[model samples]
Target: MKSLQKLATIALAIILMGSCTAQEEATTLKDALKDYFYIGTALNVPQVAGQDPQAIEIVKTHFNSVVAENCMKMMYLQPEEGVFFWDEADAFIEFAEANDMQVIGHTLVWHSQAPRWMFVDENGDQVSRERLIERMKTHVQTVVERYKGRVHGWDVVNETILDDGSWRQSPWVRIIGPEFVQMAFEFAHEIDPDVELYYNDYSVSRPEKRDGIYNMVKDLIDNGVKIDAVGLQGHLSMDFPTVEMKEEALQKLASLGVKVMVTEMDITVLPWPSRRHSAEVSLNYEISDEYNPYPNGLSEESYTALMDKYVDFFEMFMRNKDIISRVTVWGVDDNQSWRNNWPIRGRTDYPLLFDRDYQPKSAVTRIIELANAKKQ
Candidate 1:
């Protein structure tokens, strides 16, 4: 009887040891880049609400930081004047906090997606410049104060500078002039001095746009404003903005003595609407078969090309890890990526590290291998 008991104990011990080994073998993206910088992903409404178990699991396993894909946007957060919706945004913050992930508040101010009421009056005319400035002040202070110390960083301003090294004629720019960008940053700092402030924009690798952004940030710093970082929205493609261009942009931004972050990164494996390099391109076209190239699924050739592009970009990022603070993929998976519906609607695009089935692509493995090599 004593011998039987001893054998059972031995079997239990072996099983426990095997379980421990399996757990340790679960190397994640966050773990791979732990010593270098944060690996992050943007979470949509469904994932933040716990409706998408597979996406949530992927985020938990691979990422150490979280940004809301839409919940925290000004339009969604404040649909009407003087009325702010906090349900989804609150849940998003809670989810990130529960997961022990750093939270990034995406876009306190942007030209697009903002409510029309903000720029127009009851008679459908643009509000007075004074009125607009006050409204912006209230909006920035209210949102930043609500989250206070919970959010570690904020994309305080977004896409204000055009690609031609001039300010975009956005409503904010038109009403409050170029100083609106400065005002937004100042308000955020006044509300929470600890929160890191960032100016985020797409197509930042283009020379003209890079110069414009650098000058804007440099001017703000010269004026005694606290600009912590510049977020280069890495909505890249397979062909444009070569590695050298991206490196030059990063080097210039870092030279200004401000931290850099690769925010909203995704490599689109699809055709472009036009020759423009901007990801904000939103040309609408009637549904057609030609536009949907990968209707069935991505061929092995296309898959390999996509993986190569991702690995190449990751290599560049690792090379400049000193200036780049965090690297965030725009969505959790290809199925949820904004590329599927933007510029051309209903077109399937594989632009993230995970497939629609929640499986990590070949690029994820290659990226992990690259990061591990650096450690060694």
Candidate 2:
């Protein structure tokens, strides 16, 4: 059975490869990618200086959009509850607008990095469902209204779905239940009426997670909520669920009439089964122990393997560009990636197009090639 599965995976990959023959005809990687992909990256607020000029230039030369400074919803945007702060976000918004770059708002409501002041009873636990809904409505209305036309889209909610395909135990979820996702979207739509709204989550490359998103979005669509796209936060490891699963999930979501975007793509190369890692990384449910090793940083061979995986996945996406809209990297460089302490702590992780020194990685070159290749 395992052998047959391998055969089938290869067979399907071959068919996809044949269908993506444009990858072969492209003379240069950049030329090919420009035609098929929207290559963009997230920017840190502090790093947007002398570095930003060069970084934005590189992006303008190669990509189309920019995901602004983690834009952590109303809490960060309006830390004083009603008072909104756009000083940092404005720098990016204005920069992108000045450069004619598309802008994607990182998130509106999320489980993590939420302001501590959001939902607190007098005792400081959390607000009730009723209060939470009001907060959601107010936050969405205020911020979305401020940037209604300038902002291209909002990650209406981020990481509300867990790795096990269950709704996260967020304050919003604990109080508002499943309706929170719908309410978030409705409020955003009512406020902007124009900005594209998406539900963004990590590990969407997994089948269960992808299916969870599909089910939720489909339900929202059936209930008459306006959801525009799904952002697959493609934070990948060296060896994990094949892109085949990711592709299948994207196709299914597309069938639901929602656009798909590779929102936060980064491939982390970490040592396998390292004692310092947690049960999640050690268990290798998503990847075999043999495929990963300890001292979990990306090795030369692992980098190459991961790059190939990216090529295969993007080829699949290019073939389906009719539904998938953008391909965004979580960070501009490896040094900026969150993978350093995530999934594996204290271990160095190389997970972006550019290295810590801001030099382009070979993976970036190959991805460009895949993106540029014309369809056969």
Superposing all C-alpha atoms, what RMSD in Å does each candidate have to the true structure?
5.7, 10.6
As a TM-score, model 1 comes out at: 0.92
Model 2 ranges with Cα > 4 A deviation? 1-31, 51-54, 272-299
lDDT of 1 by residue, 236-305 (tens): 8888888889889988999999999989999887877676767664457565677688977899999999
Ten contiguous residues with the weakest lDDT in model 2: 276-285
TM-score of 2: 0.82
Candidate 2 on 1-376: residue-level lDDT in tens? 9999999999999999877774456543334555565667787776554455665556666556788756545556878666788888778788788777788887888766677777786688778878878877988887788778998889998887766678877788888898999999999998888899998876776667777878889899999999999888777665664678778778888899889888877776665555322223223234444533534455677777867776777777788778888888877766667776665445567777777676777766776655543543
Per-model TM values vs. the true structure: 0.92, 0.82
Top lDDT prediction, candidate number = 1
Those runs of model 1 whose alpha carbons end farther than 4 Å from true positions after fitting are 1-26
**How many clashing pairs per prediction, in order?**
0, 14
